[model samples]
Target: MDFLNPNYKVRNLLVLNAAGFSCISLVVFLLATQPFYLSDVIGVPPEKVGSAIGTLGAVDELVAVIVAPLLGTLNDRINGWAWNHSRFPSGSRILELVSFSVLALSLLGYGQFATKLFPDLWFWRAIFAVGVSGCMSIVTVMLHEVNNSDFRWSHMAFWRTQFKNHGERLLDGNGELDTDNGGNNELPTVEDDVFRIEEGPTQQTNKKHGSLAALLGVSTGLGAVFSVLFFLTLPVRLSSWYPDLSSKESLQLSYTLLGYFSAVCGVVVVVFAYDCVKQRRLSGHTPDLELPDTTYFELLKQGLDASRNNLRIQLAYVAAFVSRSTAVATAVFIPLMVYKFYYNSGLCGAEDLQNSLKVRSDLPLKTSCYDGYIFLAILTGVAQTVALVSSPIWGILVDSKKLGSRATLAVASAFGMLGTFGLCLVGRGDVYDPRTATCFILVSLLGLSQIGTIIASMSIVSSVGQTVERTEHRVIGSISGLYSLCGGVGILVITIIGGRWSDHWVFGPFLLLGTFNAALAAVATRRG
Candidate 1:
């Protein structure tokens, strides 16, 4: 079958979208299950398990900072060669396929090796961390490829506008329309009326592109649902076939299977999916369009120079990264904290805790103190979906200059901080009864806060960058890497402190995290 047909670009996009969702799901699922698997299945102590997990975060952050920029630069230098080469040359697809294969193999090895080797806690954790980081890089490359595709530019512009609109609403719970006295209609100025006519075709094209993009969103959402279901069911299916296996062994087997499946899927997409499509287009009698050959250093210089022109862009990057770091801090130790302090509370005894841990070990799943973590995960997924869907809208609004990115970021940061504070207070209140309800509410609030922050930060980043004619792949990767690095720092701190004091003082870490997040929010808002 012809793989390189330009007409098949939409198909490639669907594949990329699905791959992106799958990659994220796999990362989050593994992360959520790691603590439980290490402590219960592998027989590592709770404290050590926390350290091991924290170390992974630390490693991922460090690697991201180092790798993203370099990889981005490489991507820039090899832009057309990697993406538009007529033949199967060393390009983005090759990098993506190799990285994904390594990631999947590493994960599978960790799962199977844990059963036999019982390697040092940190060793296994580091392997998984590095694997996920590699996968993240590949995903970023794929995102850039998708963005640069002919079909995606208009969609990106629309989403950018959507994101800005969402940011405005988040900042002040209203759309762009003015609330005039008695809600009377306002007449458009002569310039506004003339400009509207001039931009009519562009607006119509954007609307058409947006409608098509919504179909892709639907596909992505469905893919996520399927991926989650597959993960949830894999363990049960394996356990039924291997009933005599230990819980740990079963969990390891499940992860290994999933890893292998993900790797195979990634390889197929990189090889026969996108690359083939590109090649087919080249072989046809179609005219060879000029693809830009921008270097990474050039893009970096442009971004840097652009930031100099607009100080707000630089501040926006810092604010967004800092806010993201603070927001993610709670997740670092929450798993370990729940396991040590709340898992074996009055409701669930040591035996039940052990059994629950065992079950999770057999499957790629983890349940925290009250299984509230699952609820939290669901809420987070929903919020992220909302933010992703609204991104284009926000971008459009920013481009139109209806609202400022700084103001939007500040308000979102404030709301997120407030949510963290609320969670901290609830944790301090010592309310153990109705555990499910309380946990649900807390997680929901966190999800809401996260959604606001996600939208705001994305808007700010888009606003700060230059509109110069060049590929933005490297800049996006570098900024994302920096964000990951900050998150890693936060996770490292939480693991060190929370791991030591969780057993003796449960509330201390929560209180500290809340305070830290609030303080960071204050700093971000001031800078914004």
Candidate 2:
């Protein structure tokens, strides 16, 4: 609760950011586990599973690309209007609550509907996709507008006024007494007489924005942690609750429970959380809300124009697209590869494996290559958990100025390439069978490398936003939306082809596309 204090506003923002991202992470978790549910539970053909999930991912990302920017522009308009219309000040908060509620209902309905009629699973998938897509876009734009900008905007200005109203004393080196700690006190603090800078609070603003990379990275990673916990417990809990239900039925029921969890969280946020950014403006900085007269089409057009004209933005988009694609491709393909190994070993299909498990449950499950979903859950969980830990570590390192973002990106890219190349070996033949130790080590390496890529690329995007703000004078949300649009493009490009490649050879996509992308990214980083 103390962390939510005004003086520690950044901490409050990060926690809320992480909470919002958890919904998306849970969505990813469900999708990751779908491969097993489709093949074993619903009795779908093995070859078709890849295509279904891949197509679903492509559609999901496509919706996000189109909807995210439009929502961002809408948000700006709403904020501009709320400035003059004082009746409803928390416009963005209202949007968030509504978006989250829709997402919650979508998840709830999708789980129940899919479980009842497996053939209708695709329909549910589309509904959830659209819901989450719009939700993520709006949340992302809100975050960028709230914290990452260089300009103080209304929030900081409001805080300064609070200090003045409270009679807080601020002392400057010039021996002047000031009420607000907004930079008046710091003007005389500079010791450099020859290169005296007029702006005292620019450094302070930079300090906050500099941590933007880490803030976003860590928040996303923490959301993954919640997803890991849900997936790991879902299977066992479902089976225990409904002993009469078959394995497939139990899994379906699990999704229904997951929906409840997501929906409840959404409700909590809506009821308790005020829109922090808008509140700042409504408090004291009301005049700042009068945004320029601009249409969404105009904003979108300018964003597209800037993408072509600004080399920094272009480079940022390329880096983000490649990095996100590699991560998505790896996540989509790795579980399939592991399942193939287990299925070929014959234990995954054995009728007596459960009986054997009941007799000697102490035995290592991996020893028999049975119950592959458990391991799949573990592997994915471990990967996501690693992401959670590494994101902040890498983000802080990159943001600290100790490691240049480009150098960090190049190094991480090279590391990921090597690890992905190692995965190429896991699919060679039964002769190169994966032992438990071998699988864990390789998967952990992949996880560590993937987080590195995420943190580095995100840091690059933050720099891009700052660069655009300096030159374009446009609201940062549209540019942030464009960044997500590139990521959506990357997902679309890879999943459509990668899914087919998986059916042919489990590691084909990982070996060819993943490695090629890594190499290309490494080269680009070096040039930059």
Candidate 3:
């Protein structure tokens, strides 16, 4: 808790953290609800719904893989001069408004397109993909500013206020009173910096400031959990509360509410999020650690060159891929698997697929979708809840001397296997029986595994960045870009193939996850 006390006020920190939360909420809601949308509204066959999801997801991630890196770079450049002269909003802020507006609008028209979802919704999905990509890019940019931008909005102003309020004692070279501990302020060695998670009170403020950045990464998981527990179940809740509404109308209302919520979140960003580094630059202030005189080309080249033979960086990249894939696949497929289970058991949709609307014809369609929703919400909420809880534990372990980053990743992969393979073997067991308990355990374990990999992978990247930064300044950006690029690629691979396999077997995606986890474990073990 003390670590979260960055130099900035609480308002700015919350606004910055909102970007990550928004990123996951926007993505998770769409994916989590898509199966129901397709089955009930789009009228797609149950057997083919998986492929549709896969194809749509593949295309979505494809756009992300391309746009994220480019847009992130462009946003950084835009923020380079954010609000320098004019009274108007910065270019980056305007871009944010447009991006979130697109996202909000995209969320509104989701199931309304219906059968026209063929090319029309395909095109719309592409537009939505652009919105998603833009939102993701914005998160990256904000995270960069949070980490690099001097850790405050105004340093000298703060000092002046302090001086005016109270007569200051001896000040440090950087500014502000030096909290000296009688010669206990020297920097820690790389071992302590990279491997030790716990920091003493005398550690540098910049190091403590990393707590904000760490929170930013966890925002995605938090967003997913929030979505699963809230947004994904909205339609069902609506159906239960309002008996007159059809399942489709319930879904539409849920989306409508979510769209507005997204817009409001966007407003929060425009109103609250400030340009940290750019404001300092305009004020003729620079951070204590000045921006290194390094170009993007040099950063890219140096990062790439280092990873050419560097096993650690290579493993980090792999970890990033698996971590991102695990997060996304868990969000999309777990609910989908449950939906499929309900549909198969005649609790959702019609028994025949070739005739009338499979999910809406003649049956109590509202009750059916509600039933599936209840199962999915419970399963997904539990998994993501566990994921949220376990994420920081991996962070602690990596920072502890008990397990190095490599060992943590391998161990996480092993947990992944235990969960993914175990679930696959269990297949979609009866939800009402004793096997349900086993299902819950497997879900929790898989969630734990996912978070572990995510923390371990990013920790490895941070470790590699620390090691690589000595030789190449600002190279962390390149390494991080590569890490995200790989993660996007991993999502692409998993959704495309895993989606197809899901039709034949409800546990197909789990099998794919298990295979990927095994590969990650093998690589981490080999590298270790």
Best by TM-score: 2
Worst 10 residues of 2 by lDDT: 1-10
What lDDT is obtained when candidate 1 is compared to the true structure?
Answer: 0.47
Off by over 4 Å in 2: 1-12, 87-95, 115-119, 149-200, 208-210, 270-292, 353-370, 430-434, 463-474, 519-523, 526-528
Compared with the true structure, what per-residue lDDT tens digits does model 3 show for residues 47-124? 788989888888877877876555544443443334343344543465566778878787777745445557766766
Q: Considering summed lDDT, which 10 consecutive residues are worst modelled in model 1?
A: 180-189
Candidate 2 residue-wise lDDT at 383: 67
RMSD of each: 13.0, 7.9, 8.0
Best model number under lDDT? 3
Ranking according to TM-score, highest score first: 2, 3, 1
* Residues 369-458 of candidate 1: C-alpha lDDT, one tens digit per residue: 224334334544454454445545533433344444545445555555665565566665443332355555554444444434444444
Model 1 TM-score (2 dp): 0.66
Backbone clashes under 3 angstroms, per model: 30, 0, 1
Q: What TM-score would every model get versus the actual structure?
A: 0.66, 0.78, 0.77
The regions of model 3 sitting more than 4 angstroms off are: 1-7, 81-98, 111-115, 137-141, 144-202, 205-214, 240-242, 279-313, 349-364, 428-435, 460-479, 526-528
**Per-residue C-alpha lDDT of model 2 across residues 41-139, encoded as one tens digit per residue:** 566666677777677677667776777666656655565565556555343455566666666666666556554223466556656655665555555
